[model samples]
Target: MYLKLLPFFPGRVCTIQDPLAAAVSFDGTVSTVSDTSCSYSAVQDGYSYNPDSYVYVDFDAHPTVSGFVDRTEHVFKDTGADPVTCPADDIQGCSFGPVTDKPKEINDVGTLALTTQLGSLTFNAILGVNQITTLYTDDTLLIFAPVSKFDELGGLCGEYNGDPADDLTIRDETVTTDAAAFVTDWKTDPNCVSTPARSMLRYHDQTSLCSGVPQETVSGFEGMCQDIISPHMNITDLAKDECLQILCICNDRDIGACEASLEEWFTTLGIVDQRKKDPLDLAIELQSAFL
Candidate 1:
């Protein structure tokens, strides 16, 4: 009897290797079976097959048979349905495991805040915060001030020593229970800016300051994370470059020479000299100092 062989139809189980290099052996029946291929319908295992899926079957030997003969015929043999085994070693760029080493702690007090406060006080004799220098001139005469005073408030305010969450405080005999009254007394006093009391009260309105010395308020990790997350908390590269340019101009004592050097640096960095031909702006744009 010359029996015509029927091509393999849907419902045939097979194993396949996915494009992601994952070897998956499925014991499911195939669907949309065609002369060349079919879709896998996983039943015993959790796997699916599509047009892209390939099944392990030798058609030449079984010209009459249409289904898979045995489980071995599948691409991946039955390893007794268990969880897919993974490699023991760590995978690069994969954050699956706990961090072995903690990140180094960074100071919470930003350099910009410290620099602005110290720089303004040292250079201009003014107390400032957030780059806004508020000079305590006679126009804004203090109505009330601390009764007790110090020669300089320099040692009073600088860097935070404790947690960043806490306010910087200055502990001195001058600090009184009534801040307004204290200020009024100090300002009205004739010795406000004279010997034995020559006190320069630099007020940082926005900043929170207490009656104690500044202490670190944030941990290194917290500080670093804050800086990384907040751009305003730290000084920008442009500012640093501008400061450097200012220093150079001062050292050279020639604005024209400084501009020439700055222009050259900008050109090498492939940056436009914007901000009224500010070299620091150009450097900041390029985000590098290759020159």
Candidate 2:
């Protein structure tokens, strides 16, 4: 699933695609920036109050991302978003930017690298055959997975097994068209209320329960808040309706949150914006932000 979707609805659990091709599950919990916070108990339990903005990716698989293999998990928190210190044993595993060590591209073992951008994460897949790029800004996390893993993965992003007919595979390996059931099964924390009282938050209601208000009025760079989807893509009304729940329970529902969410959505959906160009393409051209 796109990390950008996480902050949209509180308490919704999803298993997202990890940079190392593994599935990592997490729940959209409270928003440190909003008053109508959900999953406060879970936050007290030390879970992230804002799950998608900054995260700690627990690579449950091979842990092949270099510098982190020795450690059980690696934190992907952008330095500008949240300053963190690596464990003494795995200091090298923390690749905070602006990284002066590695080049843009290399065939060496995978490494969790952060870009110079204030809030972003970068890492090359094993053998440099794939690249996983993520940016966390404006309270949104945008993920761009490498096409090389096509047909070999499954999760909220859908089963990439080359069959769109079965894109709704749930946690139990069963396929279901019910979106609620799909989300419930992938929750990392059962204590979270995965299901909200309303299926879709209404915009007409000014109450905190109306998540659509923020989405409809979101602002981006230069006051341009249009979603930039790829020309090849077609967004359904159902899809748009489903996404309205993002702001209702966010911790920080201010302009920054709205802008960040919109920015990442535009980036993930694909298109070149005058304010923010495609990050991956820019990384390649500059030859200074990857590897």
Best by lDDT: 2
Give lDDT for model 1. 0.19
Off by over 4 Å in 2: 1-108, 117-130, 161-165, 188-280, 286-291
How far residue 280's Cα lies from its native spot in candidate 1, in Å, is 16
1-291 in candidate 1: lDDT tens per residue?
A: 000001111111112211000111111111111112211112111111211111122111113223211111111112221111111121111112221112211112210101111111211111111111111111110011011211212111111121111111222323333322322222212233321211122222112211221324223323333333233223334323232322222232343433333333222212111221454431132123212
Q: Candidate 2's error at 57, in angstroms? A: 6.1
Tell me the tens digit of each residue's lDDT in model 2 across 136-244: 3222233444335444334334444334455555545677655455444334445555332112112222343343345444332112322423231344432233233
Q: Worst lDDT window (10 residues) for model 2? A: 35-44
Q: How many Å off is the CA of 109 in candidate 1?
A: 35
Report every candidate's CA lDDT: 0.19, 0.31
